[model samples]
Target: MYLEYSSTKKREALKLERGLARVQGPPFHHCYTVSPASQPPMWALRRASVSLTLRSRGFNVGASCVKLAPTCCVEEESGINESREITYGGFLLPKTCFHSGYNSSLNFTVGKRALSSSSTKKEDDLEDGFSELETPASDGNESDNLLTSDAELSDDDGKENVAKEKEKTRRGRVESKLFNEIVNGPGNSVHSALEKWLEEGNELTREEVSLAMLSLRKRKMFGRALQLSEWLESKKEFEFIERDYASRLDLIAKARGLHKAEVYIETIPESCSREVMYRTLLANCVSQNNVKKAEEVFSKMKEFDLPVTVYTCNQLLLLYKRNDKKKIADVLLLMENENIKPSSLTYSILIDTKGQSKDIDGMDQIVDRMKAEGIEPDIKTQAVLARHYISAGLQDKAETLLKEMEGENFKQNRWLCRILLPLYANLGKEDEVGRIWKVCETNPRYEECLSAIEAWGKLNKLDEAEEVFEMMIKKWKLSSKTCSVLLKVYANHKMLMKGKDLIKRMGNSGCRIGPLTWDAIVKLYVQAGEVEKADSVLQKAAQQTQLKPIFSTYLTILEQYAKRGDIHNTEKIFYRMKQAEYPSKPKMYQVLMNAYINAKVPAYGIRDRLRADSVFPNRTLANQLVQVDGFRSNPVSDLLD
Candidate 1:
């Protein structure tokens, strides 16, 4: 039979159903009655073979019944002549309480009564129910004491969990808000945004600020990173550590120049002036190829009596390796005198220098020395060796080294997978490239995907390259670096239309079009026989970004102009390069001379222009200069006549 419930009593009906379900055994009749003197409200639970009915105040309460074990009942009196017990799910209830308000305190009281009751089995049942609900049960006076302790423990645990959750949420919000503000902030200045964040009462932690700085540096936002560093320093909220000072110095050198960065170093308090700060400056100098400034910084480190670390010496070695190979011997001699053991990087640099000069035997000797010193080569060093081996056409040696790097289990050597892809491709082992790429298929990392695309492109497998590129874009928000890789692949194949489509996709995806993307576009247009369009793209990139296009980018366009004998456009590009403040190299002048030669016109005072730019011509360029000068004395037009 169905029982009707009015809207007002629907909540009570639900409570009745839950209360009945708590009874654990064969159904038994139980009644709750108020004092006769009061407006008595009576409720009863009655069992029939298949149905149990509940009646409250003589009206059938809507509920379902299940058999449940009997539990002790408790009651409280309010100005009544008599009292009755009210039990709810093996717990106590006050006369005014509803079933939904069952509390742990009530369970403790019921447990105490059950413990003292004569029936041992009933007491065990009550204890079992208490254990299920994670409620404390005890005998007599001890129950109250145990209840107090349990409440305190539960409160402490709840507070700890809440605190941890709040901390996690706070850190997440801070990272999200601060990153969004600095990265997507208007214009180049993020200073105002940072200040606004502070004014809004957002706390900035050292870890969060450092992470933001690192991200900015990666994005090549040197100016904005410097601003953030300056703001952090000015706030004086945190004590500046040595690494903090070093990071600021590096940013200064990047955003400003080495000279300005040196000025900043002078302002750093003597207490914070450490070896790392100077090493940072020295490294930046080496990166910029400023040999004179690099040496001066190295001398200053000695003047400060800073321990000459292998890192600093390696920086000098690297600079000398790129600039003057002859000076490398001098640096090696200094390392020997100082008793400074060379690091793996030191040996790698030396090896690469020897490889560049095609000194295979010397490179082998260096490797032997590294092993003799008991310092094993790392993956990077082995990769370097493999690269040189391929360049030297020692394919057998390169293959053996690559096999060692892969080890017995290729799947576990994820770190070596990306490096191996291109090496195998260089070896013309398409099968090995495919094998390495298969290991990355299940969970491809960004670098691995990039390497795979490059490897496929190198092997002239355009379809395979495109497939990897497509898969990478779907899985990741394409960074400009990733897009540039595919663009380069398309550029190499002279697929202008595909490159153009990718550029549109990059724009739609909000990828930052940086120097790398510009380089790829320039190559794409040049390879497709539209040099003018390439030049236009370069110009637009420079204007939009207010940054210099890479030296190779300008050279690419200038070389195209040279090939066409378009001297006017070639001269224009050369002048633009000068405006961009690229160092004058012999190759640029040689390209300029080739333009004149291809035009079959004598460029008068070309040597004077080279001398004015302080660019020294090599022997071959000197001979070209003489040939161009002879043309002026004996005109080509005269010979034709």
Candidate 2:
């Protein structure tokens, strides 16, 4: 009983050590060892034994180490060692219950034999006697050749076991880590976690890891997801697990901003089920804008007894329509042969697809198909069709759709408003646009308000734009982008005081003003010849964007200072430019040179300034500066003259 408790404690300690080893990596001894039998065998035995016991108890202690150990004796023997036999005898738990049913077996051997130069080398060396067999080899046959069969068999077994063990470890780690992360959060980098899994010496399986990564991507935590996916592709590890590999490649392709996903579905392993391979291939085809491949995958999926989902089929139709509506008709014919019933989404996809391809006639067929399917096209669907009509410049058709929608008891669906309002505004139906804006005020979605405000802005209806802007601020709480849009609208109308007020209101509302605000202020001041104020705004803008003021703006400020004969301010702006590493433009050089000339600076400084500005011959202002009269008396004279 004491022995049993000691064994349990020892097993627990070894488990803790093995877990530590997996996290930190194989120990220093593992790397420097000449042979597994020679390296700190005591530590390996304890750890391996503990892992064995824990695995026996179903605790998921990995099997790779134990599986790797036998491979040490798996090497091909030298020519002189034909008579030798290698015996590996160790405790491997039975496939049954613990202490009650357990019984020990001795003198076991793996089906391969190689030499071990230990003092106790024979089978009889065991405390319990076990018999051994010897076989004769022809004298001319080398010992190495005689041992070849054993070596080959052991090597094959070792590889398979090692691969299986490593796969288990990787799968265990991935499942546990993902479960923990989902329960908690992205506590550790998923890519780093995957890297650790990859390091387990397992045959790489892309599908399992890709699915894991795709889940992470959906949560917007794409950073590590992208890294692992790229690593998998570069290593060609993607071929082993090709099932969902294509689907994950789709995401990676999108994330990378590629025009198409660059994966060959045929490279996927035959071991993967048809459904996984089909979906993944279809997904990749769709992501890459290759509807032809998608259709091919769809057709081939049938052979695998894998039915393409309505979602995938819809995507294929879209791809066809986007690339060519003539292909869309072909897709419909294929779907009809397959007896796949089109859903509202399927119909919507057809309409949207035709709209994108400018296939108005094709869109009419889709409308007819929707009626045939007993699916009444909703306003949202109508709105999509309206957009198609709008794109075709068929305002009459678009207005008809909108008029039909208005005649219905429109329940203020923000989605419908977003689609319909733009069409109305584009059609010069300002009254209809205004009515939508009023509806948006009562059922205010952030998206609806922005769309309404933008549509009003397009119509140059400043009062209506301002009304919605103010209402958006009060209702949804102003975001910086929203406020910036309002500021831009005010600036567009040359409402300087109102723009200024909006800037102040932005601060009062606790909305951040970005570089846009500063640029707007500086531009207004420069246009108004309030260069002093413009320079002040420019200074603030520079601090915000961490960018040096451009030479043109600085030159304008310097021109104003030079006109007022404020040499101190002009020098300050010049030095500020140098400190900020602002590149001196030809216009800037001309402005500064003229400033020095007009300020009555010495002839030497005036000539040097002209030389500096004259570097660019096409810069007319530099030539004009030196020729203009009383440049020494008034910098303004150069401008006025």
Candidate 3:
């Protein structure tokens, strides 16, 4: 029993030392030196005999020091002597677990200090700092080899992880052609691919289908995701769980609307109930803002004994906020009655509603309640508070809130973004504008994207403006207003061909060219002194839109041509304006008359037009005519001093 106790204690000590060694890397040493024999000698010993042998070897069993008896045999056969190893012959005081290595000197060192350059060193073993030199060349084609396919974007911190995930998924190619089709091809093609595989006697696991379905949804290819789900439901080989049906219903809600989603709910098997389907249905109601339907669904859920969550209540509250704010109280009361816990989002939205209604005191109380409930204010909440302060003209309060938010390095979400982006832009906060621009680009509304693109132009970030413009065009179809804003960007950058191509694309897509688009083109060309191009855009805009140009647009064209002393084109524009029934502005003809006068041309042409019109341009033209060689009809043109 004594020997067994000692042996157990030794093993425990060895384990503890090894643990310590792992924790204290590099400087520690292992406790025992391994010596290989035909078999492990320690196995043959009696329990007490092993203890006797351990103590007899001068090991001092409990002591930290482990000494080795000499086991070296000196052989004198060759000219050069080599170390011969028989067995263990070294002291070990271990903290680092190391495998055995033969050392003839048997020098044991423990817990050595880490090496640094300040330590004394010999010339033969010299170490020096790196010399000043140019950086090494990089492979230019390396960037070309980077993953360019649009993988589903993750958050900023998860970028590397997502990249590595994509890399691994890309490398772990499955031999199954069906799996390849699902991955390589997007959407509904996955259904066809799976069918092809199954028809050939192939099988699929639940995990594979679930992952593929999830991947499709993540990529926002909902149409294809629904197709796969429908195909699977039709197959006798596979059965979808409750969650699968719920997910399919959600995709329907998104791709279709609440009506179709309701139809989808009817088709669900009796196995699915309010508890399983509530989230997807409530999310649809949230999107559709169908208060009546939402209320109906909530009542049905209560009838079916489904537990209400804060998210469901939040949606009902959102619908409530749209019409009767008093209905918000019912939601809160329902949440309390149901014992549903509110998340930070719940409190934040409540605070925002209170702030917006000008119930500052109520807002503050909710904030206090939030703190009491241990719900911290997030970016959206802070943004709402700051905007309220701004609206109340409390600049200092807004500044304080912004500073606190900045100190936390808080990333803005859709809520804070929509509120604060225009505010930052209007206030000329360029850096904040840029940071907000990145957040806005994730899923920007047309108005916000147009605002961001114009803001980038204001900051002279031409490339960034172009990038945002392209992204907006690719993601959402542009309206006349958006395209006009983009045209102005191209004008500012002097990329005329790009502007021309953009306008052409707008036409090809059956977008009507509004007066604003024409004005934008005319203004761009007029500012650049391209009178001919400006006139071309105006005529096409007038003809294609079948609507008269705004009086201001006509005035701009007249003014630009008059400034160039091109009386002929200016007069032609004045006649077109008259024909278009644009109420006459006297500035139009006076500009042309002055042009004819300064160009040393007779006022004969101007006088003839004035004579034709009695009221319009009569006084304005007469005033300019008195400046040049007194108005005379049928007179030859001549230079005048």
Backbone clashes in model 3, listed as residue pairs: 21-95, 29-94
Give the winner by lDDT: 1
Report clash pairs, candidate 1. 23-68, 24-68, 24-69, 25-68, 25-69
C-alpha lDDT values of all predictions: 0.59, 0.46, 0.50
Error of 3 at 553 (Å): 25
Candidate 3 Cα errors over 4 Å, as ranges: 1-190, 196-205, 337-339, 358-361, 387-393, 408-423, 431-464, 467-641
- Predicted candidate 3: what Cα RMSD to the true structure? 34.3
Residues 570-591 of candidate 2 have per-residue lDDT tens digits of 7788778657644333344445
Q: Compute each candidate's TM-score over C-alphas.
A: 0.66, 0.37, 0.43
Deviating ranges (above 4 Å) for candidate 1? 1-181, 184-202, 295-309, 336-339, 600-617, 629-641
Per-residue lDDT of model 3, residues 1-641, tens digit only: 00012345445534543443333211011143332121111111111122222232223433243332211100000001101100111101112122222211111112221011111111111111111010111122111111111111111111112333343456453333333456554443656777776777866777677676655554445666777777887774476767777888888876676679888888888975556576567656644445446555655555455555555655555554433333344345334334455555556555555555544544555565556555566544566677666666767777677767556434532434434554565445689888876776666654467668777776777787778777766665445656777788777677788788988887787665666677678877876768788999888768874444655667778877777778788889988988885433334556766677667675655555544442233333445766553544333444441
Give the C-alpha miss distance for residue 151 in model 1, angstroms. Answer: 63
Q: Is candidate 1 or candidate 2 better by TM-score?
A: 1
* lDDT at residue 240 of model 1 (Cα atoms): 85
Clashes of each: 5, 4, 2
